[model samples]
Target: MRTVADALHDRHRDQLKRSQLQAHPLLTGCAPWVIRRVAAVADEVLFPPGELLAEQGRTPGWFLLIRSGVAEVARNGALLGVVGAGDHYGEVPLLGRGAHPATVRAITPVHAWVIGAQRFVPLVDDVRPIRETLAASLAAQPALVAAARAELASRIQSMRREGSNTWPGIRPPRRRRSVRVLHVLAAIAMFVAVAVGAAAMYHPPYAVIRPGPVVDVANDIEISGAAVHPIHGRYLLVMVHTERPTLLSFATAAILGHHRPVEHVTALGGQPDVERQLHGQFTKSQQDAALAAAAALGIRPSASGALPFTVRFRDRDVVGPSGGLVYALAIEDMLSGADHAHGRTVAATGAIDPAGDVIPVGFVDDKAIAAQRAGAQVLVSPTSEVYLAADSGVRVVGASSLREALDRLAASN
Candidate 1:
């Protein structure tokens, strides 16, 4: 019933598919037409000698069908087998997301056809006869058969529970990638959430200096059991915010002029201990400030026998000894009612000893910049290294002790 040319054309198609599919054991039961279709869509490629065709343990994106020359296959760095013309390589990634068993390299100049994995799956799916034949082969293994049966029952039960008797459209390459896209997306989202949470809650390794509340130190101190006079200028507090500094964060803070190294903080063992040390330093500052204020106001602390008062910081953020000079000044104002500031805005940063000597602190430039922006008339520091603000508008004054600071404040007013 067929012409000679028609018969010959059919015979050639059948022979080509048979030869191609039979070349690999994996495609043994596959219908000839499936192989024919695969060959139709493949791209031809040529590789020079000594070229690597593919690597082991990598997710394969394509299947290579060699047409000429030779290729060497190796597994785990050991020589495995050689593939020549008519040989096909790659299956692990095509079947499911598994590492390829071997790396394939060109032993000689080679010609091959490459089929992408996405295009290959549908070819396999269309061949119902081969799929069933392969499924039967799998069923011959008791363990695989049992697992398949159990899974099937479980899926059916689930569908019934959901009020559906039919299975939904399931995407295939039932040998699809081992890792699902949804799982990857969820992991990425969780990682991002955790990073944000850590940034919000974890203390940073770097410190920041900025203007803080100019509270009444008198509220925390008294002289001769009597409330001290209110200081006209609010005593400035240089508040510090610690950042989780890495090389990147450190660089950013440095460029912004506010980063202090963790070396000094960790010198006390750890951050908790460092925090405790700062609190102790601040406490000492309060005492020293009270005594200095009493001396300046001509109010003797010895007369007020154990003159002690509590200093309550409205902001729980006070972290270092840099606020000593300002604290003492506030105490002095409240104790003597000297009106030293004369209503002018003032700010200062320095460490202090019991003798009321102001010591140099870190991040002076940052504090100066902040004070200048706040329209401060006088920005005081312990040393002569002055940090001019953006507009260079704030005046930088040096103070060696509480007496010096008070003197400077009064003179400025």
Candidate 2:
């Protein structure tokens, strides 16, 4: 009599063969389209002897239907039974009740139809018979599993004695040593993949500060409640980008020497919402920049309230007080009726107070690099951070306050 395997071999299409040979009770009386849907995502998996099909206490990721060979199912080291051709497993765990109660390991070379949980779970909900069959199987699992294991184990023994690799009707395929080599290579690849995945998911304790956009604040700022004048110079605001270090990025940066690492506490400032906090700081910096500009212009706030002049930085992505000095200079230059930049590009980075003091900010070196790359001829920074500027091919001018920075820029002119 021709076996399922022989019939499968006769078919030209592998999917048609799988559809017939790997038939489960769930597909019984189901529509042809339903069967075709399952077949679409089904994959044929081969397991070497001693390979685990599923582990106890672990959630099943695939539903397996045995097409050939035998596997031993065990719970806590005790063999519950054996499963062979036409036997199916993994429904219970996929149902979300609990993890696999038993471990299933291939005792002989195995070929099975495997459907991943991502695809299988939806079918259980959409297909009635599949859900019903799995539910029935789950309800009578204990007694049914015991009886099925005994019968399949005896049948497997008979097939083994007959020198067949599969069930009674199927002829065994010729075995080769290369199958073992393929299995070894697959195992090594899996281990390497897992190691790489784990490393990628692991977050390091540091971040990197890299050169970011160099924005010309002169043209980008919106000032109202004051007479706005046309500007001829660029006051660039230098920004530094920070990123959480990954294994690959860290290694690449180490080799490149293009970015510098900083401790998490320093980079994040211990804020869960660092971006939001920085944006807030930027908002305050704009206010301070406005006040500092007014102080430099000798425009004192009224006794009732500060000057009604409003300063709004256009680039919403800029999220720090590093542009405070630059913003102040832009406002002062625009309100002063003359361009301090003199049609030249000048970059500046520092925090500022309403009193016009230029407070040093971190990432000065990175900002200097950004300034140079943006073709800025001069970078005005806090006196304290001027030494931090590397050999960036740009002139660095140190200033302790807005008034001093203005004087320095004038002197440069």
Candidate 3:
């Protein structure tokens, strides 16, 4: 048998060969020897939906190249853009020795290839075409390029307008002699100024802005009816019967705040006793324990005369917990009179801390898919957990706090 060190070297060599095949165009054209050299220092990554790929403003340890699936890019709750298959992202900071400009989230389950900076930087020095292509691509993107051009034009115009030079061939019209004419002119100028100001305030270009608090109201209520359990089954199917649909509504709303919204709750019929199943079968003791746990969680038989209700707050039309922050914030904002649901379906997922920070929860990908199915358009998510919001084709925003999510909804409305 080969020695342990020899086996490790063989495994590493195989990994390097794989990396060489996935390298970008410039690197792709390199000789086999060079490719092998680069691959020796590369790493591979696989991220499921809702996994964080990278954070904003942090120096990246690896140069990331997406091999498959989509990733969302955002900064301060505003979506920057999407990075899809075969794309190279997260290189800006690495190349410039600057802070990361945005956070990268996996929008779909992803497979990526990574090269450490120490090895990648030296390769870039020899690959001039790669550097040129990257620079050109960055400069050509419409959003960034257009903004830069507009700013440049505005500055030039300002310099001209503010310059002291007089027109070479034209003179100002002599002052009007009539007071009525002067009054009319002054009124016209004032009207024009007001119009300009209003336009500027109301029609600001649609640049991404930081999100605000989210608030949603109980729009309607529905009851979750009864469920039957088989006497011999391993798990007990217990229906969560509630008099106030708002309680379930709030839970659903909170779910929507962080993830995309589902068109409707899957109507799973009843809650399954997962713990009992793990024990192989439900005994008398297991049933009692399950009941006790449910009771502690406030799930019990409804009292007489308790009306069944279902309240639809807003639907993100996607499934997942990525929008939890937005949903919770929407509820709070509505309660505080700071916002109203303008009839747009909102969806999100995440767990809300008492202090209003959205904590990462589970099932982000499924939650986004469910929310999309429900027709939710605006998705709010915690900044830390948005990678789970991938590939459902819904627009997603990231919020650092509950307040930020509410503000995003309020402003959008």
The candidate scoring highest on lDDT is: 2
TM-score (C-alpha, index-matched) for candidate 3: 0.33
lDDT of 3: 0.49
**What are the per-residue Cα lDDT tens digits for candidate 1 across 252-322?**
56677654433323223333543454566667666676666556656555554554444344334465566
Off by over 4 Å in 2: 1-197, 200-205, 252-256, 263-271
List per-prediction Cα lDDT, in the order shown. 0.60, 0.75, 0.49
Task: Residues 75-194, candidate 3: write the lDDT tens digits.
Answer: 665766566555777556665555456677664455677788787787677656556766676556545444334444555576798775766878888886666888999999999888
TM-score of each: 0.43, 0.50, 0.33
Give candidate 1's error at residue 273 in angstroms.
1.9
Where model 1 places Cα greater than 4 Å from the true spot, the runs are 1-224, 245-270, 303-305, 308-315, 387-392
Clashing pairs in 2: none
RMSD of each: 31.8, 27.3, 21.8
Q: lDDT tens digits, residues 1-413, model 2? A: 99998887766466554445334544656777777777777887878645789987665689987765556677777766667656799886666445676788764346787999999988789878778888888777765445444444555577677875446666779877555888899999999999788767776766677888887777678888999887777889898777887776776676798787654532354333544555677788888999999999889988975787877767566665777899899899999876788888999998888889876566688889989999999999977557779588899999979999999998899
Clashing pairs in 1: 95-175, 204-243, 204-244, 205-243, 229-334
